[model samples]
Target: MAKRLLFIFMVFILGDIYFFQAFTTVFHTPFLHNAYWCIDLSLLIGVATLIFFQRQGKDIQRQAGDLITFFLIVFIPKLVALPILLTEDLLRMARGFPPRNIYLSEFVLICAALIVLVIAFGLTRGRHYYRVRKEILSFPDLPDAFDGFKITQISDIHSGSLSDVDGVRKGIALANAQNSDLLLFTGDLVNNKAAEMEAWISDFTLLKAPFGKFSVLGNHDYGDYTRWDNAELKASNLDRLKEIHQEMGFKLLLNESIKIQNKGASIALIGVENWGKGGFHQYGDLGKATSALPAESFKILMSHDPSHWDRVTLTHDQHVHLTLAGHTHGMQFGIELFGFKWSPIQYFYEQWAGLYQKQGKYLYVNRGFGYHGLKGRIGVWPEITVITLKKSVS
Candidate 1:
């Protein structure tokens, strides 16, 4: 970790130097000069802060420090490179271009200013805004009793990262206001410890649905990432987390299936433990969970990571009509506009967010209800997804 940090620090310094040099060659204005210097100074100070925190210890303070340094380490270089690359594109368009230094400088400065505004907005308003996304899905196998059934799915609360109690309460209120028939939490109720959820248990417990609330374990729930005193303690922490879900009135499903009956019609709600692809935990057993269920039952699955959908659920013997998952969190950054959605995580996760259909099987990956490492969102805002199941018209 120390070596990695040092490498990042060196990269940051070099990138800052390159940006400063490039900007100075273009514009010699006193204001532009001072601003670039200030940015360089800030980058140096950020590196120093990271070293201090990392050397001192790893705690909430260190996590917060990492978040601060990450933004600079990741974005500062991109901000610098963007303009240089833009100038390269411009030069390619014309032969014997006289190197439009002034225009390049102005454009870079404008872009820098825009970045500041965007960061400020993302830190302030973006983290607090919870966008409620409603999706209506039609399935030929959906039972008539479940037709028009409204289900609300929220994932990756990461309660350990939340600092605003009122903001969370408001999000909870927004979810309850939907009046969905079933409430489902795909996973990651807490970051690492069950204690992180103590404060918000009351608020989350208020989430009501006639059919009931169901949830499954997420990668973070097992306390695998955190160092524990002993194996028993880690197991105890996971046990307590599962207990907390029950307290929140959620049926914590672990390789289990339950029947939801209404008006003599029935559907299976299967919950599997975290089963991710490549490096993530693979504790969920789809075969074991569905072993006793009737083969023809209309099934809805809750698996925390969407990778499972592609890896196993799609080709499973039993037809799972719809699967709910949330893990990528859309990398908490991306562009989502009308009919256009793209995130870097997409390259890593096929079903990162929103709904996807393949060979009649549907997967809906929630954007998550809370922030994670960065502690703030950009274009990919926190989400509360409401899905209505509609019976296909035939």
Candidate 2:
């Protein structure tokens, strides 16, 4: 752990040294230089302090979140400037002389400034900038009576991280405005403790849909990240979280399936506990969830992590036409514009954000309904997904 911290410190120092060149070249004022170094040094100290507190197991959730947000605000712009300055240095070395471009430093500064503006907005307003993403999934086997059924999905609420009650109220109001036939929450209702959701219970209860609201657990819902006095305490916290779901009018599905029927036609909604790839816990049982369902049932599944779709759901004997998920949170950062989407989380989970289809199965991974560790969202804003189910005609 010490070695890892040292390595991280060295990397930050190196990056600071490399990025300082652009600042020096672009700004002639000594005061500006002093301010820049002061911020950097303070961030370095904060990082060290945060690590120490974390190692000591102190409750530094808010501090850690703030430090991460500040560090990224400082680090990302400098990171953007690195390649620009490096390109100029490479040209100088290749020619064995000073680079001809006099405006390169200024250009790098401008780019960094723009990035700072974006990051600032993300920290201030983007955390609650809920975007409603709509998708119309057509399935040949869909029940005709259920065609045009609208489903609203919001995942990774992380109520513990939410500070702006009005922001959350607006987001919930927006979800209600969608008038989705069914509402589904895909987990992470709190960061760690069930008590974190106490304040927002009323706000969430406002989310309405004609077909009723349902949910499934995510990895964070298990209280796995925090220390408990005993096994029973941790278990009790989880039990309370489940009750909280009910208090908010959500029918929490552990590893079960229920039918949503209309006009004598029905579709099966199967929900499982958090089942993720890599080191995440595997509490979900796909077989148990779908065990009694007919093979021909048009199934819509609610699983927390998108990886479950790739690792388990796709090949399961029971065919699930659509799966809704939200664990990745698109890393709460990334670029998604012009019909192209990319987030660092994609490297870990193939179906990180938005909609993905494979072998006739559809999965929509919500970017998340709330922010967590970083306390803000970058390009990947919080999402409320509305999916309309349509029957495909031959």
Candidate 3:
């Protein structure tokens, strides 16, 4: 199983690089005008899927051919559309119609395509956010201690989504408006460097939580994806990110738990390093973090990936009453309106958005505070989670 999993991971990584290059190459080219406007995302996804099947020891040559065909279909026109999207400088270089308007109208078309790309990219990114939120659990077993607790959770802000400083400020402002008793961030504060959030630290500082503000690292926080070329610099990046969290008045939780007390009522909250059960980050020691808590205590686990619920929380002997996670962004495409919610990412994830309760355990996966791929949100807007925990009153 592990070997198969690794192979699939390799296929996914390779397929991603191949398709991304194919698309970028087309986008930067001046030719390949034979593409169409009636394109759908399924073509590319199908190709990606074929790669998965090939890795699973199904068929490779057929899948590879399909991928090539899909590549040709998307690659050519994307390049064809690029010049049309650009200004006359590069526009004249391509063979578009009506000279300047060719470029202008094509540019408009590209912008429209961008809107679709945002939806698609956001949807893809949103896959990780699929966590069935926990039910407002009632711990009447005699906690008489902490009731009516409100914990605010947000994740995957991917701060790079903003163009200027206020964009980051605005995202924080929205999250702060929730007035949560305990405000928690699950990780991915900045897309790259710790200093990238330098200008926005004060904004995070504006978040007011009576109990306290706490956070953990996400996959991006470790600086693992870059050309680090050195272990020291990468380690420093993670360390500085921790410092930034502390500067924002957040108690950085790393493979550890802290008991928060209110009105003489105390509950344990634990957070760990980035843990992804999927093809992502390392799983934090859920058992080790919770080892210090009383076996009977009402515990809330704060690992970044909701998949941890399935991996550890659900079947564990130490009943974790609630788990808060937010790596998935709800694929940034689903519609949640007027009592209805749906997204394409749901097919890949069992709990894509909202609250979910299974086998006496709960996980709340926040949709996140900012966009990742494109700056726009369609059906799934940037989220502000306001969870009020009250007695079941049952």
Q: Pick by TM-score: which candidate is best?
A: 2
Q: Which model, 1 or 2, shows the larger lDDT?
A: 2
lDDT of predicted model 3: 0.67
Worst 10 residues of 3 by lDDT: 126-135
**So what's the TM-score on candidate 1?**
0.87
Candidate 2, residue 316: lDDT: 93
TM-score (C-alpha, index-matched) for candidate 2: 0.93
lDDT of 3 by residue, 122-168 (tens): 34443232222333556554266566777778788776544555555
lDDT per residue (tens digit) for residues 1-394 in model 2: 4676576567666668867776777777999999999998898799789889889987787888888888888878777776666777787898895633548777877888899899889987999999989999898888889989999999999998989989999999999999999999999999999999999998899999989999999999999988888999999999999999999999999899999999999999999999998889999999999999999999999999888999999999988889999999899888889988887576667888988999989999999999899888999999999999999985
Distance (Å) between predicted and true CA of 107, model 2? Answer: 2.3
- Candidate 2 regions off by >4 Å? 1-15, 28-35, 99-102
Best-first order by TM-score: 2, 1, 3
- TM-score between model 3 and native: 0.67
Any idea how many clashes model 1 has? 0
* Candidate 3 local Cα displacement, residue 206, angstroms: 1.1
Highest-scoring model, lDDT: 2
State residue 111's C-alpha deviation in candidate 3, in Å. 17
Question: Candidate 1 — which residues are off by over 4 angstroms?
Answer: 1-22, 25-65, 68-85, 88-99
